[model samples]
Target: MSSIRARLLAALLAGMTVVTLLGTYAIYVNARDAVDELFDYQLRQLALSLRDQAVHHSFAPPAETVAEDFDFVIQVWNPDGVRVYFSQPHRTLPGLAQLGYASITTPDAEWRVFATRLGESIIQVAQPMRVRNAMALNAATRVLVPAFVLLPVLSLLIWLIVGKGLSPLKKLARAVSRRGAQALDPLPVARVPEEVLPVVCALNDLLARLDAALTAQRAFVADAAHELRTPIAALQLQVQLIERAGCEEERAAATTDLKAGVRRASRAVQQLLILARQGSDAESPTLQDFDLGELARSVITGHSVLAAEKAIDLGYTGHEGEVLHLRADAAALQVLLENLVGNAIRYTQRGGRVDVAATRRPAGNIVLEVSDNGPGIPPAERERVFDRFYRGTTAEEPGSGLGLAIVRAIAERHRAKLELDDSEMGGLRVRLTFPMPEHPPASP
Candidate 1:
């Protein structure tokens, strides 16, 4: 669970350290070679000076003096090949031939030698290899020490720079941490990086969904409480009356009230259950092809009792030529039709007309219409008619106000359109228009 900055810094430091080490090694080798060249130049120049002194000035030093004065061993051989002057008289150090640069070794130690002719003799200057190597090692150390100190400083600077570069991320994390659980406002994206724009956009979308869900939950609770309390209170009052009954007659009266209360409570409970089912999940099974006209006819037949009681004529009146094939949940379609027809029957006056019709329009739409010769909805209030618990202008009817809302919900589920318009019989019209199937079978 290492942080990104930590990981990046670790990698950066590792790379820098490796590169610094390699560069340091290269610098060290260069320094060593530079020191070696200096030593060789000094050796060559000393041999030339000694040669000039012997040939021109004849300033020869005694063997003991020469050994003490000179920092290195020296050898002089006469033209006849006899050793004339030699430092380190006991043991002669290894010597090189004339002309080019060379090095020689002896049983005791190794030496870098330079030989030149001095008139009648050869003067050879040989310095011990130990002195030259010590100088090179010192030079290499001088180059390595500064590099070691500078690498750590450079790595620290890089780490700080990386931290500064990632400061925006730290701010974002802090901003998110400080938000309340119920807060669903969009994240502050003004200063966010383009690299993180997609994440911010996704978070904003999630917040919007969460806000919608919370609003729905609140509305549901309020609506349930408001709807359930009425029936529950009615039931309570009815039970109290039954408890206070003085005789059979009084008890009979209480029993009637009790029955009405029970019915109301039962209806409220049913509406609640329907609302619950109508929740976000479209648990309705896959839509099956069904006859809209036949379904409308069946609903009209079922509600004939209401029409009869109200003295209204309930009948279907549209083209009965072909089956009204539509893709929708059959049971839901039946419920929708039943509600529309029943409501029409209940609202119509005695001897009024209630007509159910299903027809396929030329534009390839199936329209299901239920109308009555009763008071129609006002233009201003038609929109609210689809809200749950929204009793319309005709509130005297026994309804949970959920019928039209359920109709709307089902219509949406089927991707159909429901409109309220003037009926042909001059009353309210509830029409559900569904899209025709892509391919329709011709009438037999």
Candidate 2:
């Protein structure tokens, strides 16, 4: 029953059986009616033929002759309603009645009798109902026997036709099963039936997306390995220097350099990890509503000590007490804010100012900006600054060039638009615009 072929066969065969039975019943009823009309006509004709003759009581036909002629009984009666002459002697017979054609039931059998009078002498022709019924049954059988005999042949034909109709699906399954794991090519569409074309096209689309994802993953791994090589070699050289220190002061100095090298190498590895996580296609961001301004202030607070160490002034300067609510992945947004603020603090000159702000525009779009009074990126290198391991010409800081790349990746995940421009403070400004829902959730 689970198989389509079996289900179809069962349903079709059941339907055919029901139709055949109904047809046979209809044929039997029609045949029986026709036989009754024909026998009744014959009864009337025989009675009429005898009406003109002298059915003499002295010259009665033999019982065997009457039985063999037409399985009928004949009788001649006088006007007095007395038993006159009967061709066949039986256990019961129809009593004389006044009628042209009538049906009478005797103790032995049901009889169809026809009577006609010829000048006060009556002739009756009678036949049993069972004879008519047998004729009807025989006619029905003759008409329906061919259909009954062909039933099994028709069932076999249905099975073969159903199998032929489903052969395309079987071929498709075999073709798909024969492929290797790495074979992401689309299935061929030529000669595909219209009914199955949609499934084929959707599968092809899925295969194409899988291929693209794998290619991107391979390139990311290769780029990450290539970018990590320089920092690792630098750390090794620093370790060697620390091992070959000559005196106490020299050993202390070498140790300090080694510590800085270790910090740089650790920062690079951390950045690579963040970039990899942001670029992953498998992990989807958790979207929720949060106060964007509060998040901006929290990031600035975390980077406050660094800003102070560089003698840079960093603060939030958006609408003072108004809440700027945004719906996005809160964790990813936090990382984006941290990278932007850290970069601004690191690259800004001493005594320079860096400001962070989050604001909601009249159009319900949320905008975030981080600006600094540092040597900004030139217009030509601004676009390339977001590429992994790409440093600007004006960059004088000794650090990995992954901050903006990480920020861009996070922004893209949140469907935000990021742009770099000259700040009003005579430095670089990074702005991100996030689209808002028409009916945003209320603050809790």
lDDT of each: 0.78, 0.87
Candidate 2 lDDT over residue span 70-128, tens digit each = 57888878888766778777547787866688989999899999988867878888899
Clashing pairs in 1: none
List all candidate RMSDs to the true structure. Answer: 10.5, 5.8
Candidate 2: where is the Cα deviation over 4 Å?
Answer: 1-4, 7-155, 442-444
Off by over 4 Å in 1: 1-181, 195-199, 279-285, 436-444
Candidate closest to the true structure, highest lDDT? 2
**Superposition error at 398 for model 2 (Å):** 2.8
lDDT of 1 by residue, 1-444 (tens): 778778987898788778867876777677768866887798788878886563322334455555354557777877887666666765656743665467777897877777878786788777777776676667667766887788778778887998888887778778788999998899988978887778788889988988886887689779978988887888788789889999989989989988987886787677667666655544765677788888888888788887888789889997876777777788888878877887787777779998889988999888888888898888888999888889977567776787787778778877788899888778999988887677675565
Give residue 28's lDDT in candidate 1 (0 to 100): 65
TM-score for each candidate, following the candidate numbering = 0.58, 0.70
Summed backbone clashes in each candidate are 0, 0
